[model samples]
Target: MQLVDFFTLLFMLMGVVSAVLVAFHPNVLYAAVALVFSLLSVAGLYGVLGADFLAAVQLIIYVGGIIVVILFAIMMSENIYRARFRDAAGKFVIPTAVAALLIAGFLKLFHDAKLETRAGLNAIPTTEQMGRALVGPYALVFQYVAIVLLAGLIGAVVVARPHHGNPESEAEKK
Candidate 1:
């Protein structure tokens, strides 16, 4: 009956469709585009669920920053256009089946246990409280994340190093 519920269902459906396309698409570029659409759809669902801050952050930070970086990386990498995108689904079949069984077992245990949610005692999580907890108590984790990001940047530069080998040697190898 509500507009939000309608949009939520629509967005969820769109997200699932795009995500499936992303997984099954033969071309990496198409897959990337599908993945972006999927992420945007999920962000829209977040907005429908009344988490505007999370929705905006998801769209801006993840969809904007991370996806753009990945797309750029795909473009910049060697043998991208010329290479064939291999479907690696067969590789995941056995492992995925095992994981699904494990997950089903967990769900069975969870449902059979009949755990009641304590609603009154628990307050809805607030962004302000989360920020305070992160900056105050988990400040070290913030620092660690910064270090990890820095290391990733360093690794990227090192791996993409155009100056690593002599031109003559590189030419000979090629």
Candidate 2:
């Protein structure tokens, strides 16, 4: 196989493994860290697919901004490290059914699709076009996303803040 193909497979494997870790890891902090690796793998896939802008955005927005905020929130919260998640055995049936259906649908779609190999598939830099679209046609959507992100950040800060007024009591509680 070619080098690019090898890298593609490696990134795909990394993404899949990290995603499993994100889902199954009991420690919330460890799961968040695994999520970072998963996001990084996705960014690598975007890079391989020649979507440089998307790769950068994935790294910047997800790994850099969102994950950092999540880690900080987890770290700042009291007793979160001692928290344990309980498995809800009864709740898995519906989600498992939906996942099975989705997997089957995807398999069928791939089986029915006609994929042809193309020569001279050059990587086109889409940064300029993407920037223009975001500023021109999708300006409102971009602004709305920014607003939502800002609100989430504020909410995280509020939720992570100590409830009690007395500093000595807060330390004792921790």
Please give each candidate's TM-score: 0.65, 0.69
Candidate 1 lDDT (Cα, whole model)? 0.81
List candidate 1 stretches off by more than 4 Å.
73-92, 95-125, 157-174
Clashes of each: 0, 0
List lDDT for all candidates, in order: 0.81, 0.86
lDDT of 1 at 62: 83
Give me the candidate number with maximum TM-score: 2
TM-score of 1: 0.65
Count of clashing pairs, candidate 2: 0
Q: Which ten residues in a row have the lowest lDDT in candidate 1?
A: 116-125
Which digits, one per residue and each the tens of the lDDT, describe model 2 over residues 127-162?
889999999999999999999989999999989777
lDDT of 1 by residue, 21-85 (tens): 98777778788999999999989976766566788899999899999999998898787655544
